[model samples]
Target: MKRKIRVLVAKPGLDGHDRGAKVVARSLRDAGFEVIYTGIRQTPAMIAEAALQEDVDVVGLSVLSGAHMALVPKVKEALVAQGMDDVLVLVGGIIPNEDVPALNAIGVKGIFGPGTATQEIVDFIHKELAEPAA
Candidate 1:
């Protein structure tokens, strides 16, 4: 049997705004996936630790402190340091288009911004994980 995808949705840095993260977590849950939400104000190391402990298939970070550049790379580095490079890293919330390429270059596969439909995020993850590995 194919196991359900486990996702860790986190709010990193000093961002207190959590409505978006909560909404997406609910949406993903409704879609029948397992979601672990880490609440708010998480550091990169804390998030990485949670992801490893939960053994999640994906880590979705919500950053609105304009620190996406600094935060995302740190999280990615922690994941790699923990030997969890296989986990897919995703980001969302007020990210500038210019930062998108850099985020991808640092190992984040999905970068959702404001106005991005939850369905799109859900669908993308589904399609991405469904592809056969070469």
Candidate 2:
């Protein structure tokens, strides 16, 4: 059997809402990915540490507070500092198109906005993080 793709889903900063994060975590789990959800009130450092401890293949940040610009890079930087830079990073939530470039420049491989089908997120993770099928 192929190794299951492992994902760490995090809510960075002070975002009190986690319905979307929980939904996505369930979707990824249903799609055969092992998901670790860190829940709300997480700092970038906390997220990175969880990613390291979980040995995840991807880190998915669910941010709805519009602080992606500030928090996302910090998570990436922390990942780099912890030598977890090889892990793929992704973001999902109310991200604006204007901020997409900046997020990409910081190594976020995929960004899913609101109303994006869970299947789309699942497919993207499979395409980007899953190992090639034998």
Candidate 3:
């Protein structure tokens, strides 16, 4: 039987605001994913470690402090270090439109900005996991 998609939704860096992350976590859970939410202030290393330990299929990072460029690459690096690059990485939270290309270049599959629907994020995960590995 196919296992349900396992996702790690994490808040990285010093951002104390968590209402958005919590809402997405809840939404993904309701959408039938096994959501592992690591609460606030998790470093990139901590998140990558947790993702590896949990053996999740996706890593979703929510950063609202305008540090998406710095945080997203660090998380990707950590995933590479752990040989978890096969795990899809998605980032959301206040990302500027100009920064989307750079995020994609660094292996981010989906970028969810403000006003992006919760179902869109969930659907992205579904479609990404369905693709055969490169």
lDDT string, candidate 1, 11-114, tens digits: 98997999999999999999999999999999999999999999999899999989999888999999999999999888999999998888888888999999
TM-scores vs. true structure, each candidate = 0.96, 0.95, 0.95
**What's the lDDT of the predicted structure labeled candidate 3?**
0.92
- lDDT against the true structure, per candidate, is 0.93, 0.92, 0.92
TM-score of 3: 0.95
Model 2 TM:
0.95
For every candidate in turn, the CA RMSD to the true structure comes to: 1.4, 1.4, 1.9
Residue-level lDDT of model 2, residues 28-134, one tens digit each, is: 99998899988999999999999999999999999999998999999999999999989999999999999999899989999999999999998887788655789
Encode model 3's per-residue lDDT on 47-114: one tens digit a residue: 99999999999999999999888888999999999999899999989999899989999999898988
| Cα lDDT for residue 41, candidate 1 | 97
36, model 2: CA deviation in Å? 0.7
